[model samples]
Target chain A: MMGNLLEHMGVERDRLHFSWISSAEATKFVDVVKEISDKVRALDTDKKFAKDYTK
Target chain B: MDTCIEKIRTICADLLAKGKVQKVIGFAEGSIPMASRPIAVTSKEDVAKLVFNATCGLNLANYVSDVLPKEGKIAVTAKGCDSRNLVTHMVENQVSRDQLYIIGVPCTGMVDKRKIAALFEDEITDFIEDGDTLTIVSPQKKEKVSKKDVLRHNCRVCTHRNPVVFDVMAAEPVEEQSLDQPFADVDHIAAMDPAARWAHFQELTKNCIRCYACRNACPLCYCPTCFVDESSPQWVGKGQDKTDINTFHFLRAFHCAGRCTDCGACVEACPMGINVRDFTRKLNKDALELFGWEAGLDMEKRPPLDVYSPDDPNDFIK
Candidate 1:
């Protein structure tokens, strides 16, 4: 379903990432989220790639 | 016995006739012998089939999210664990408390059908439930086994015995069990070295087909738009790669965090025999230890992740 939604919205597959982090590994979850955020920020170029992705 | 079935039918009939509930979700004898599955009864004629016994282990609370009423309340049958799940949903504000009519049953403990199947090599022709004792009949032989012997492992140490929230209870409430030694396996895993732990996880998750049975079975995973299914930002890849499978499972476990009630339904539903409870149990332990909170125990309490504390411990922060 996520795949279909992304396809319909014309979002590139490489832009998305997911990870599993246990509750004990709070650092790991934070790190992974930070990494994803950095990657997403980097992808944000001069061209406005649909703002709907912010949510 | 037959008395309980008659009483259930009468209650359902009255509820339907008075327009109290539009649907009554309970258990009916399944197509397979010695098993019962969740059924939705809309009419009084179908209510006579409602039965409650040790074999009704499937959490009917999971159906609340699946079946939403259009006009009136939905009547649901719940055992101890199922009631806790309903409380969890209410606490999380997923479902309004007023929208449900709960028929709570005091659970002795439900039998694990998979464990019973594993005990016998031959096909089970029939079974009888006499109080807490279960008698199994096969073409070759018949065996009587104590219900405690085959009860689901989670039920053995369950702390919640009474329905946390119920509109009408069917039986007297049972005393809660002491959970002084909860999450023993989580401690064992935590004691393991990083390499060995990763190896163990790889072995468990390597065979995952990404069926989403774990997510579907969980009562807390009632999100209409799960992050995995969110395509706007594409949180997870859709490929069948082992890494993707691992990612999906991990993200799901994280998403459940403080909200997991340790029902172990995800582990039971997983076809790959993955120890899904290990991750969830670890989260449950963390929620209790770090925040001094237990999910589903108190409907008034908010989930730990739902609210943040400025002075919250961040040992994980680098």
Candidate 2:
């Protein structure tokens, strides 16, 4: 629900990743991390919700 | 509607006189026109002060928890939306059903005071409703407008015009509106690109003064120590910073996921005229489409967001 709401508010849907992996499945975890990293890298670095106090 | 008020007053008076309830939470005439404030009547005489009108926009459910007596029961006059909120409170354990005597009023939507105000050149001095027509009197002139034309945005799209649960109904149920596009407002924003959607929200909340009126007005926001007040881990800043405003609105709406009934209390309470429902309406649409859930309908069933089941959708999780 949080992911969907964030996406609705204009955040990139790919920025948030949800997964379920057993603790024993180390290889699955690694693959999920790699997939998430690649998706994050593909998107431009725009912190729409981030606060810059310098302003 | 006049008969509805008389019935409500008679019922509340009887309850108070019979010692069935310690107080009756209802709306009374506000100091200004087009604003009926909530009142807690303790005596039979005070029941006459109760009134039900389109100007009574504030939800009575927001007061149920606060006005509830420790040892005695209380009666509340509820509209369709307010009754739904009362159910939300009971489901959340903030209030018990046995301790409440709900006097239900079949709602015929509330008027948008802003819309009526916009039509007048001077301050509105009086408002009179007769059937489907409203007589709005200002210092300059009197204008007759149809009640349907000035209906509150949420009320215009409301599907529940009758109370889901009530001890006694003041009037018979009215016809409920069935809309073809209940979430058209949310879909409009969803159609925008990510950047545009962000900009839309930014502009929507730009006039916010951080007054927290929306939080105070919402029946769902009953946390004893709200996230914003937590200094140790303040979830939102106190100033009117854009990011802080956005964060506050986002977190607040998120907290109401699966719980909000789209009562429009937050929007009614907003002094800046911000349509705070823009955030919650999206969640309401998601809850309906994804979970087939509309909040505050059944007290026995737990909210979808708070429960887990094997049949629950997991497509969002990889």
TM-score of candidate 2 versus the correct structure, residues matched by position = 0.98
Per-residue CA lDDT of model 2 for B1-318, tens digit only, reads 878999999999899999999999999999988889999999998888898998888989999888888998999999998999999888889999999999999999999989999998899999999989999999899999999999999999999989999999999999988999999999999999988999999999999999999999999988999999999877778998888999999999999999999889899999999999999999999899889999999999889988997888889899
lDDT, candidates in the order shown = 0.74, 0.92
lDDT of 1 by residue, B1-318 (tens): 334556667778889888899889898987876578789998888887888877776678899877867556998888778888888888877678888998877777777777787768899988788877789988888889999899877777677766777888776777777876777776676666644665566677777888888898788888889888899998777766655665686678877788777676787677776767766676677777778877777877777878788856554443
Task: Locate the minimum summed-lDDT window of 10 residues in model 2 chain B.
Answer: B233-242
Model 1 regions lying over 4 Å from their true place: A1-55, B1-6, B230-233
- Each candidate structure's TM-score, on Cα atoms with residue i matched to residue i, is 0.80, 0.98
Clashes of 1: 2
Q: Report clashes for each candidate as comma-separated counts.
A: 2, 0
Name the top lDDT candidate. 2
> By DockQ thresholds, what CAPRI class is model 2?
medium
